[model samples]
Target: GAGVSQSPSNKVTEKGKDVELRCDPISGHTALYWYRQSLGQGLEFLIYFQGNSAPDKSGLPSDRFSAERTGGSVSTLTIQRTQQEDSAVYLCASSLAYQSTDTQYFGPGTRLTVL
Candidate 1:
């Protein structure tokens, strides 16, 4: 992909449902990241993947949240038993290198609304 791509740009789900958001990072990039942004809150890192190393899941909010990056490229973020408070924009970014912060590019984001 040329840049990060997120599916279902807008998702509206009833509380307690599960949702899977997808991200396709740029080709040849080795670093991928997921972030969540609430209405008035700044972006919060959810996870980070670099090559075949263990993913950094430090930012995931709870046991209900999980993610996976396969083939060191595509990634998926899953939120189980979503709640109204879970409504927010999920963003994905990718960089060519783990230290290439200047090269990170963000996706349009998947707006999840649990109502």
Candidate 2:
């Protein structure tokens, strides 16, 4: 089965611009999550989705950050009016289900750099 995949592994963008990062979860996995880890910091949860239910977007840093999961699989995280603080590794993970203790396998991540 295919593991989670993210494109442009590294992205360099200008401040105040918008960028979209894509994620493809593993096949048959029912849960997907987005997290960001700043330099020397632990992972910060951004959003999570399970099946066709409403996604949990509580962890999004600000209104400028938004995401959507489609067909219970692929998801896209979009940053509107990107800021310097938004430069970090955007990681995507998936588990068999949306359980608090479920182990999540992570992708190499898309590193976004705001210039």
Candidate 3:
């Protein structure tokens, strides 16, 4: 019975490099989301996945950011051509569903640093 796990707790990379952050959500979770927390700004939602389909990707800051969930379990957030502004703690969360009442369970997060 694992909660949620994210790999490469700390990622340091040069500017313009691509990084893929992985997340394994709890079993049977149908809703998965990718979020980020940066300096000054509070937590921001990047993408939401219902099963393997991303229905609400409006939160993605730009086209360079994308996410995907497979088999309603695992998910990945890919940052293409990473930038200094993209440096933040990438958080992955899952819930019973996408309803407002559903409590979200978050992972430890992967801290990405763009040098």
- Which structure among the candidates has the greatest TM-score? 3
lDDT of each: 0.89, 0.90, 0.90
Candidate 1: stretches off by over 4 Å? 100-102
Model 2 C-alpha lDDT per residue in residues 1-115, reported as the tens digit of each score: 7788998799999999999999998888899889999999999989888985545667889999988888998889999999999999999999888897878988889999999
Q: What is the lDDT of residue 26 in candidate 2?
A: 88
Candidate 3 error regions (>4 Å): none
Q: Per-prediction TM-score, please? A: 0.93, 0.94, 0.95
Candidate 1 or 2, higher TM-score? 2
Task: Give the 10-residue window scoring lowest on summed lDDT in candidate 1.
Answer: 49-58
- Comparing 1 and 2 by lDDT, which wins? 2
lDDT of 1 by residue, 52-111 (tens): 464567789998998888898888899999988889999999888898544789999999
Backbone clashes (count) for model 2 = 0
Q: Per model, state how many residue pairs clash.
A: 0, 0, 0
Mark the 10 consecutive residues where model 2 has the least summed lDDT. 51-60
Q: Put down candidate 3 lDDT per residue, 8-92, tens digits, no spaces.
A: 8999999999999999988888888888999777899888888899987899999998887777788889999999999999999
| Candidate 3's TM-score | 0.95
